[model samples]
Target: MDGFDAHQRQMETLCGRLELIADLLPDQADPTLCKFTSDGIVKTLSDAQAFEEKELFPALQALSLLETDMKEIFAQLREEHYEDLCFAEEVRDNLRAIIEGHPSQSANATGYMLRGFFEKLRRHMAYERYLVSALRTKKAPGTPDAS
Candidate 1:
């Protein structure tokens, strides 16, 4: 599959997992669930970041497939990636605290953080899908595929 399609699948999986984690946050009774979700988030974010930086961004740049305005969009997406990384790290820290017998936030606070992160992730994915559709619509000047 294309990079966009693969990324979309990965994102779909991540979002589904995140949704489950969000649902579990209210009870805060399962340390195993917290650990599993935290680990998944860390791994998924790392893989997604690497794929975007090493594969997707380079290909887009090499082909000049995106319009000039897309540069701003790319920048914003990169920023969002950074933000997601930070959020993931925070989640990891919370999990660590729970594991280490340290004081942690209330269940409500944890739930709030998770819900906000999930919402942001959904929004980010939607924007990326829009960008992919836009790129698919654009063709180089004078090309046979140009409309």
Candidate 2:
């Protein structure tokens, strides 16, 4: 109903979609399925990064500059974002390698790596939700808020 609520919902949906794709990845054994899932994951990661850059990062920046606790929280979030960047990069590289006909071991390793990345990413999303909830509670009512 409110801006914070909307943002929370959006974040939840985004994370859910990512989880769905991650879950689907293991079910795929054929190389084509692997490629499809890899591409899908890369796309999802790109969308997530764009959302963070355009929306989350700016909001966190404003909050950090204005509130001490928010600044700490933002620092943590920024760290998580950096981790996400690494995971996304690894996923992209692995996917590219697979596309390039890299060895089967590389594909297997990438699959394992992706599983770990997704798990970490899911935890990071949960942490972000907690941070967002805290900020939302602190924000003044009737103030315009970004989605």
Q: Largest lDDT belongs to which candidate?
A: 1
lDDT of 2 by residue, 1-147 (tens): 134445445545544544554455434445554456556654565566566656665665555534466556656766777777677667656655655667345444655676677677767667666656655665545534543
TM-score of each: 0.74, 0.59
lDDT per residue, candidate 1, 26-74, as tens digits?
Answer: 4554677666767778778777767776666654554576557657766
Q: How accurate locally is residue 87 in candidate 2, as Cα lDDT from 0 to 100?
A: 77
Q: In model 2, what are the clashing residue pairs, if there are any? A: none
Over 4 Å off, model 2: 1-28, 40-43, 57-68, 104-108, 136-138, 145-147
- Measured with C-alpha atoms, the lDDT of residue 80 in candidate 1 is 83
TM-score for candidate 2, please give it. 0.59
lDDT of each: 0.68, 0.58
